[model samples]
Target: MTNATAERPLHSVSVAGIVVREDGRVLVIQRADNGAWEPPGGILERNERPEEGVRREVAEETGVTVEVERLTGVYKNLTLGVIALVFRCRPVGGEERLSDESTDVRWLTPEEVEQSMKEVFSVRVADALDAAAPHVRSHDGERLIAAA
Candidate 1:
């Protein structure tokens, strides 16, 4: 490998699940680390597939088992170099409970999601809810900065 290639910064990939129930409520968690309300997810392990990572993260944070439907959005945190793959999923089993990573877990309506979450996170849920093709967006960790 070239010296330049070895010296380049590395980016981390994360997987998130926008778990939706039949009544249209979307699942969310209040992070224990920062108390921010967002979808349940975390850094993907190198050995796991994106879908598997999503299921594992959601279950770990929210105690909810999900059936991944499809990827709904790709979000990049420009400042952190973290690429998040967000998926639309259905809750197949399990119950809502908080873990060490999350302080609270709840199923919220789309409006509640917009009201409670930051723009970067709310957009992920909104995109998953929409029937259009998956969205590609970038954010500065708080607000959206670009779209494709």
Candidate 2:
């Protein structure tokens, strides 16, 4: 058997966008499979750039066109080896519509998100809303943990 050190490690890179509207509302989606409401995002494709992947994922999941403003956070799912880059964006065009990935989409205020979403997910949106500095956080897919 190959030694662990010799085996190549695998990790998936993902991107998420927080699309804020003019009226101080953020766009979120209820995933079809799990009903969890979070920002629109997905794993980056092998041939795609980070910005392009984020834009495509948002459009596919929420049917909204966004102009990426700036990166707002970085998160890692430690158990899954998934690294996520979160960005702040503005809705440039398109309307909210259901897609294969998302079952529901809606605009929510910061208070609504804090009450509805889990801490890990809420932190992503919160970071975007604050727009102070980029947050780097780690999680076990559900709960955020203190970085080691």
Candidate 3:
């Protein structure tokens, strides 16, 4: 492999958790650096499994423990070469608190998410909320494109 190719992989795998409380509120976080509200997630570690990564990311960002239920959707940011596996999760324990990665954490209703987030990020929550079938989608980081 070329040095440049070795330095960066073709794409990166990330995991996101769509956590919902019994009250039907969804978890959302405002990023510390960007201040954009979205689900809790991050890059999967080298040796971590995707499900474990999802759990860890949610706990780290929102300070809530979760039980991952099932795969909800898969999203790709085509512009950034990021593939994110989103899972449906149920809150198990822990009180909400802000981490270094998050500036704010809130439990929002479905209507609130639609009003608060951009379409691309909001779809992730919508897919989970539907809880019907796994959605596979691609985006240019802001707008979603029809799946290929």
TM-score of each: 0.96, 0.93, 0.93
Residues 1-148, candidate 2, lDDT per residue (tens digit)?
5798679778999999999999999999999999999999999999998889889999999889999999999999999999999999999999899999999999999999998888889999989988588989999988999977
Model 3: weakest 10-residue lDDT segment is: 1-10
Q: Which ten residues in a row have the lowest lDDT in candidate 2?
A: 1-10
lDDT of 3 by residue, 1-148 (tens): 8889799758899999999988989999999999999999999998999999999999999999999999999999999999999999999999899999999999999899999999988999999989499999999999999855
Output the TM-score of candidate 1.
0.96
Q: Count the backbone clashes (under 3 Å) in each candidate.
A: 0, 0, 0
List per-candidate RMSD values in Å. Answer: 1.4, 1.6, 2.0
Q: lDDT (0-100) at residue 57 of candidate 1?
A: 98
Q: Can you write out model 1's per-residue Cα lDDT over 1-148, one digit (the tens) per residue?
A: 8999999998999999999999999999999999999999999999999999999999999989999999999999999999999999999999999899999999899999999999999999999999999999999998899555
Per-residue error at 37 for model 2, in Å? 0.6
Runs with alpha carbons beyond 4 Å of true place in candidate 3 = 2-9
Candidate 1 vs candidate 2: which has greater lDDT? 1
